[model samples]
Target: MLMSPTNRLQRLADDSSANSLSHRLRARRFQLFEQLIGGLDRPLSIIDVGGTNRYWEQRGWAGRDDISITLVNLEAEPQVHANIQPTAGDATDLSEHADDSFDIAFSNSVIEHLFTVDNQAKMAREIQRVGRAYWVQTPNFWFPIEPHFLVPVWHWLPESTRVAILRRRGVGWAGRTPDADKALRVIQEHRLMRRSELAHLFPDAKIVGEKFGGLTKSWTALGGFPALDRVTA
Candidate 1:
């Protein structure tokens, strides 16, 4: 039998490629998800908002068993088993799926990508519509620097100064669509959400936990960025 992706990941601990960031992020997410949904055996369905097949692959492929992991993205679908289906769609509108179709819907650093305030609110509604619970996490805005990938909390910066900071992050309105830039350009606006801000989306959902990532020593150590994990409406 072929070695599993998680096992392979262990062997790749020393990988030096720059693309390794994506892999490491995915691994961290899997660990967090495993921790959250540890007890339940065979959830009826698990939808990963803006997720990839890498999720199923990393979980020894067992997590995908009986789990309808519908990867939501604007890009083309990835190659995965039937248990993993990729849909080219928007989170603001998930009307394609039946109501209560998924036991859990996961989104990591995705809500910020929404183009409009209305769209972001609609995305929350869609997630709440399809899944029994939502597992969403994003960079905390109350801190300093840009939380994009733990640059620091830039939320404290004034709009004029911060937008310039975001321009440095490849966000420009010159060629971008008004809707697409709502989120993609928020970096300059210092547009991260605090715990209260997130709570507003799902007033009924409680904040289950918060975590500060990194532990120093690592170059990209984001130990400062506060990450909130919530199970809300």
Candidate 2:
């Protein structure tokens, strides 16, 4: 299906690679993290679920040595900087970690991949259980552009239509092939949550917006950040 002119314009404006929008959003998120961590002393312990060391490396945060990070995901022994530790763990069940095991539980673009609302809830509960604070980010369902495909409103289509499109090669944002069976399998794993769903999932956390073109592009749920009250105040 062809995108309307208005949607095309919006997609162009939201394109991550074509402009500084993604960069600006990431910087803003980092600023929020800094604010949340402001009252805390150094050598913070963080458990990053569904995250890799490359994310921290890209942020290039100052005083990296002062912060201890653990990367948790399905894969075993993820490659990371010497300063970071890697652990194999499930997002829905982190039973190995006791309550408040880490200063922060961080996840980026991970919740949507849970494939089900129940799974997302379980993961949310686990995050809340294991960490004193948490920060989780996921693309907004209402956003005109889909982050993975960079396509305008592709996710708005019916599931069957989306699967059909996925079966066909070379039919996605900017001439990318997203129709292979493997791609379809991966795509099925993602079930984007609306703002309300996010709120329900993390009732204690504040839902924050990351916007592009004056529209919310993604949502971040911040929980248990000590300075959050002061920062928002």
Which residue pairs in model 1 clash with each other?
144-152, 144-153, 145-152, 145-153, 145-154, 146-152, 163-188, 213-223
Q: In model 2, where do residues sit more than 4 Å from their true spots?
A: 1-20, 77-79, 170-184, 231-233
lDDT of 1 by residue, 79-152 (tens): 55878778888778888888878878778667766745666688778877887666776655554434343333
- Candidate 1, 76: how far from true, in Å? 2.7
lDDT digits (tens) for residues 15-115 of candidate 2: 24335566556767788798789879778999999977656776774237888888889985655566688889899999998999999999988999887
Highest lDDT model number: 2
> What is candidate 2's TM-score against the reference?
0.84
Best-fitting candidate, scored by TM-score: 2
Q: Which residue pairs of candidate 2 clash?
A: 166-179
lDDT of 2: 0.78
Q: How close is every model to the real structure, measured as TM-score?
A: 0.65, 0.84
